[model samples]
Target chain A: MTRLPGTAKTPGGLYAAPSLVWLSVFFLAPLAIIVAYSFLTPGALGGVEWSPTLDAYRAIANPTFGKVTVNTIIVAMGATAITMLIAIPCGYYMARSEHQNILLMLVMIPFWTNFLIRIYAWIAILGNEGFLNDLLLSLGLVDQSVRFLYNRGAVMLVLVYTYLPYAILPLYSTIDKFDFSLLEAARDLGASKMSAINRVLLPNIRGGVLTAFLFTFIPIFGAYAVPLLVGGTESYMLGNLIADELTKSRDWPLASAISMVITLVTTLGVLLLLRANGTSVLGGDDHEAAEPAGEADALGAAR
Target chain B: MEARKLIDISMNLPHCALRIEDGSDSVAGPVSATGNGLPRGRALQGGIMECGGAKKKTVKGSDVVIEHVRKSFGEFKALDDVSIDIRKGEFFSLLGPSGCGKTTLLRIIAGFEAPEGGSVLLDGQSVLPLPPDARRVNTVFQNYALFPHLSVFENVAFSLRLKRAPEAIVKARVSDYLALVELQAHASKKPSQLSGGQKQRVAIARALINEPSVLLLDEPLSALDAKLRQHMLIELDSIHDKIGITFIYVTHDQQEALSVSDRIAVMNSGAVLQIGTPQEIYEAPATDFVARFIGETNLYEADVTAVSGERVDLLTAEFGAIVVTATNPPPAGSRISWTIRPEKIRIGHTEPRAARDGINVVSGVVAEPIYSGFQSKFYVDTASGAQLKVIKQHADWSDEGPELAWKDDVWLSFSAEDAYIVEVRR
Candidate 1:
């Protein structure tokens, strides 16, 4: 076999060396240090102690930590579900629309501003004396300002809004590559409008839907700012709990232990989702069996 | 062979005679007439019972009558007052270059598009108001449009499953259609795994399983390689024969249209210029556009100088006087255009002794000679400085013989009947 330039045996490894070194220095080193710190005792002065202990691991069984974990999962799942409901249609329209680029630009326009600024802008709209309340009051639909902000509902809404683009972009990319003629083919083959979309459109873009779900769900699960700003004490999640453990409580070992648990759980969740989607996170060889029965050919023939 | 058998069976059926007499002669008769003349023999054999078949059975195919249909996309008119009558069981082709509205017309028939005006009648009932699913018309999209997620069996059974067909019935029908397309072995394969021709066959099988009265194909074979395309064309023709359904095929390739279509409508700029049987379209083109678009032809602009009983003498700019045969001669002094196919012109080294009156002969030097495997095209520069193309077929297998090289003096001759008059288009 002819050796390609820069891809020959030793040179290929040499080419990858810099990225490997960078990842090792930035990621592996930090992760190793965190793992080491997770096992050690907390210093009195908010620093690491050389003495080892399983106290941090034992503390993970606390009811408060369990509640925080449950709350985090609930909020993430809620945000993902709501985002998908809105994003699928939005992505489908953007993919099929003639002015796709303009629509995509509009979807991305929010990203041009600072993320925090946009979040604050939402505060102005959803606050007690905000635009929604003022409009409702002027229309005589409400007797007084309702508590729309600083609640679980507010946190979910803001999370969904903030992560809507993540869901839409991946969905749009997959849907855009979709051959819409399949829908037409379905319709032509004696399928009703809705049946055509359900049978042809949804199944074809399952990968994109899964990708979008994971993209939004993982980040929102570990989100810090959205819950901190919008959520009340009752809505405290794993992110807030971890932040409190590190800052207010100044318990570095327990915090590190909690961080490791979160990392492990998130990684496992992502792996399971990826496995269900028939893709691999670490670039392993794909294991999905070839789809049986050529749908297009058989459909065309049937028609 | 299968087509001939199908024709025989259909001809023997008692109800076939009435179908022939119900104005289907113009479309159906000519289709079989052009295809090996076997259908014509079968049609004639069944003619004895023509007057007395009681109980008209429902025909297997649907008749499409597009009346005064017009469609526009913004400022651009895609179809302008286009009308056509596609007979049941006829392979009709809409032949045109790109952007000539052939695909648009097919889409309208398939109910993927709606016309701005007029109505589309299928089997004497207006289908214009119906959605695509409600109409008994299916389309084989240009790209096949196979669903990547489903298997071949599911794709073929999509329509049946939608109608909630019994699982056994769906399976049996899907297998039958797949077998028809010779894709039974590939029933479990995905579309991505099949070849282009295989995918096309699957698409045909899918459309056919719906049992549509009319099947519309939108340039379905344009994606295959040349050899595969020819093979698939034959397969498509056989499928049409087997089903005996009206096939409204759209194509830009003239040879493909001529090879498969019973009748062809040549369109340009959203308007149909001529509609005729393949032979009629080829041997006697109605207009200059049809003449040039169908095949290669040498066209000359001439002024009619004299008109005899069946011959018209014309004065051309390059060739002084040329006599052409026309049953009804045009008036003298009228300017007209005439076309002669390159194949009609005989090229030889010396003047032929059999040359007769009304047969024109011109001597010219071979400007260029291009030798293909089966024929040679010679560009002859006449004494008047006008060049004419002549194609001569090589009947015998020879590496080199009867060669006419560049600068060789050659004689070109054509009978008056070989030159046809084409209407001058402004």
Candidate 2:
């Protein structure tokens, strides 16, 4: 298994040699280094040292680190759930109508403006003296000034707004390709409107949902921007802790250890997801993952 | 500016005035341009009226009616003032080339599109305002939008689940339709796991499970290969026979339409140019468009010199003159087209025995011989500077192999009855 795939079998050594060399030099070597670093203790200077220790992983079970992990999961799951809820209906509507280009553009136009700028715009909108508050006060809907920023709710809102386009695009691609005839087929079979959506539409776009979740969830799990800018003491996430370890405290060993632990956890989570769905995470590049019917249907449904 | 161009083009669409099939499964005749007067005495030439056989025969009422339905996409008119009546339980076809609004018309019937100007009726009730589910008609879309996420069994059972039917009944019906499409073994397989033909059958099973009043197919076999299409056609015919539901099948493939539809509605630029049985449409046409579109034909522009009971004498600039006999299409005038089927064109070394029967024959030189296995097509240059198409059956050619060489002068003769004046109102 360690030998280059076709190197031993091939009568012609010419084709096999270059590929084997490239794989060893580029892929296998870097991966080995990463694995070794994950298990090793950091040097007093900066880089990996020779001492083999499980202390890096042991510290991951600490209450503070555990809380960060929990926070990451919640934010990731929250962002994913919110994006799915908003994207599915919007994507479906856009796909069904003849005027899809305009709708698609509406979803994308916000993207042309810088991501940081969009986040800044949100700050203005959510500020106590912001446009929303002003409008509400002018309309006599609110009695006094109200703060909507510097909280988990604010982070969730920004996550939804920032990652919404990503979620919708995958969903739209899957949905746009949907053979509406299947829905009609369902209807002809005595399926009602709600039934058609539930049976046909929902199942078809399951991939888009999972894909949208992964695309948004993974990034938001490590997201620091909206949370940092909007949040204060309580809203500090795993990203802040990693940055604090590496920068504020000048604790390279602890930082590298934290980095290694986070990487492992993420890799494991992804692998578990891929596995539970009967998809092979390993062999993805060499051979395609055999996605189960549900995920395939979901992905295709959204497209 | 582009939007304005689109709106202008859309607003000026012509109407689709096609025949109406009714609840009783019979041609209720077309909604006459004159008004609500049914064919009083002599409308259709034959007793080609009885639509469906046996069982429920309700008062003849149009199942579907479209009046001045028009739609546009960015300056492209998809459906122009299209009006058509699809009879209940009849296999009706909408035939046209690509981008000719045939699918648009089908979508309009299915309530997928709201016609800008016009109303659609299903079972004598107006359905323009109704949603697709409320319209009670199922559509078999061209691209079999089978749920890729679902196993064939689950895809078929989805609608049943939606309707909240008994689990056992859903299982039974799904199994039955799966057996019908010969995909019982593959039912556990998802649409992605199935081949294109298998997916198509699953689509059919899914649509048929609802048993809609009208089953609309938008080029259902367009994706399949020629061989698979042939098999699908047989399966479609059997399914239609067994279910006896109105099949509003749409396709640009003339052969498919001619083979399946009881009556075909030939549409052009949104307007229905002609509607008739496959045989009648191929034989006697109501317009030049119809003559050219339905089958292999030869058309020659001629000046009308005289007219009598169901016959017109025309002077051909190049061939001197010829008398044409035809069924009454409209009031004849000068500058009419003379159309004849390729098979109707006769070529012989010896004089035709029935040449005395006022045969309209013209001298022509064979310019090209195109072999088509069972038949050879001869493209000939007539004295009139027009190319006349002639078909020689392979059996008739013998060892000669339609031996007419290039530029070989030969007399092309046909009985006056074979030549018809094709819809010349000029």
Candidate 3:
């Protein structure tokens, strides 16, 4: 076999071999176990039986599973849309402002605290006897404390709040790499301010926007913690159902099948997103989708 | 001599009419006489012509009149009471080092920046109130900021498309412009696919397709390598020649400004030091800044002692009692400074027997000699510890020549006509 210059047989492969081994051991092996569990029949006790059957996959067609799937899609899509709407402008400002480091630091401040603690803190602020209701009641703006927690609105608010930083970081990276001079050039060529942003600024940073959308959407789709704490019965999603099947009902086969279905759906969604953006998950050659020549040189040379 | 004098008089007479501060009837008379038409003359006199009419005139370009423009950003005065007049169809350069407001002035004319206290008149109409999109001007930005997502054809067609021109007309015009820049074959390719020079050509084509009265170029060639920059400079001049539109080019490169500009305004510290033709700016620079900024020169502080019709004798600390040619000499007992370009000075192995009336010579020892292919530069240290630089062109290819090595005594001679008197600003 011909040895490449930077692989083990060449230098590069030798360097990359450790990470490949790690992924196979920690991720692929567990995933393979899950797939096998989904195909097996349940045991008389809590373990799986040796016989293979399609009963777990058939159970996925139940009406409750259908409701959970639709609810998950709604919450995930809503949170993704709302988070992105706020993140795009926030990212643009963070990237273009003179005080970019300070703004970025502020965006990252919430990440320093634990994720579960931050969601709980939101509950303290939004609950009936919490800070907001107490302030409103004292100010005579409300006759009584309103029920703000344990609702769909509370779940969505917390979901958008939780994933906002994820959206902004990727969006900022992409928009920050954009050459601001393109906007000026567009205006010089007779484009109005609005048209310039629409034509030049938005199109150039579409990759970042797409990346931000997918980064928020995927995690929110399988979200469980925030919904359990703040969401009411109507807000229960697929993640809640999966937990119920695995723990309360002890139906490992059915839970594994649902988990597999969720994974398949999310994987398809990611693939679709990447395809629409003309990018490959593995980052193959896409000439039209590549960064502009000057921008690439500017960034590469800077590094 | 009389015929030459008559030619000089005739040349200056028309310019005299143009130099009228009020810009009244005398200006119109000569402008009309030059076949610019009576309507343009009346418009020029009134300073109230429509921008469209101005563009349609046979003159083919708009005149830019900046009247005492002053701009400040917080504490730093970027443009301090600066004024200039760019004639129609002229390739004018705003030449200065960084932070000298050359770029700021170009931006103000493009309506990207608004001055605090001056009016910018384009083709005799004030454009200060107009926004960038409304103005009939386009800029070729410094980095050739072509849109990355668009094809080369779409980038060139951008302005026409914005105006909602018909599809057929837009296609034909865009293709024509692409052919002009020699990028028709690469029209479908994105900007990321082309080389640096190709990107710059696309930028130029995009700016020109608008057919603005004045095209602003903000150091458009600074990003390229030396070879490509020179090649592009030639192409830019030819494009300007063919289109005959006024070009306001901004650059800090003296060679670029000198090689391409019909008139150049040399700026320093947010102020214009001098404005003139290339020869006038080089041969008769108005200030010490202009003299030092434009080229290499040997400057000397001297006291004027005698003035005798076109020749002034000065007492200098270094070279004693030097005589210089000056049409307007400073009065006796006044301190002055004069500059002699290195290329103008002649180096000799031995001193000549007699000095001519308009010639100044000084004896010095060669401090250093640097020899490139075309010329040799010698730093000669005089008796008073002043180092005067001199350049000698290697006209003959033969290596055989009178060699002046380190510490060799030599004499430098230069004519009074070559030494120019510059103002010593406090």
Identify the candidate with maximal DockQ. Answer: 1
Q: In model 3 chain A, which range of ten residues has the least summed lDDT? A: A294-303
lDDT of 3 at B362: 93
Residue B1 displacement (Å), model 3 = 27
Expressed as tens digits, the lDDT of each residue in A1-303 for candidate 3 is: 233456657667888778778887898888888899999897766568879999999999999999889988999999999999999999999999999999999999999999999988998999899999999999999999999999888999999999999999999999999998898888889999999989889888988988898889989998989899999998998888888888878788888999999999999988887786774322322222111223222112211
Give the lDDT of residue A191 in candidate 2: 61
User: What CAPRI-style quality would you assign to candidate 3?
Assistant: acceptable
- lDDT of each residue in B303-411, candidate 2, tens digit only: 8877787777888776777877866633545687878899987875444556774687777888898988888899888766788889977654354334666777777
- DockQ of candidate 3 compared with the true complex: 0.28
Model 1 stretches astray by more than 4 angstroms: A1-9, A37-54, A279-303, B1-59, B395-401, B424-426
Model 3 agreement with the true structure over B30-119: per-residue lDDT tens digits: 222232211112223333322122221223467899989999899999999999999876789999999999999999998889999989
Off by over 4 Å in 2: A1-72, A86-145, A159-208, A223-229, A241-261, A278-303, B1-62, B192-196, B306-308, B327-335, B395-409
Model 2 Cα lDDT, one tens digit per residue, A143-172: 986889898888888988999999899889
DockQ of each: 0.32, 0.20, 0.28
The TM-scores of all predictions, comma-separated, are 0.86, 0.75, 0.84
**lDDT of each residue in B1-426, candidate 1, tens digit only:** 554345434433445532344645222321122333122222322343222221111235788998888999999999999999887767899999999999998888878999999789997899988988999999998999997776777778789888898866676778778878888878777788899999999899899898888999999999999999988988887677556678999999999998787679999988988987776788778888889999888888899989888798988887789889876678888889898899999888878669998888889999999999889899999999988989988645742346788899988999899888787432
lDDT of 1 by residue, A1-303 (tens): 223456546777678777777888899888888898889999886768999999999999999999888889899999999999999999999998999999999999989998888889888998898999999999999999989988889999999999999999999999999999888899898888899889898888888999999899989998899989888977788889888988988888898999899899989988887786674322321222223334444333322
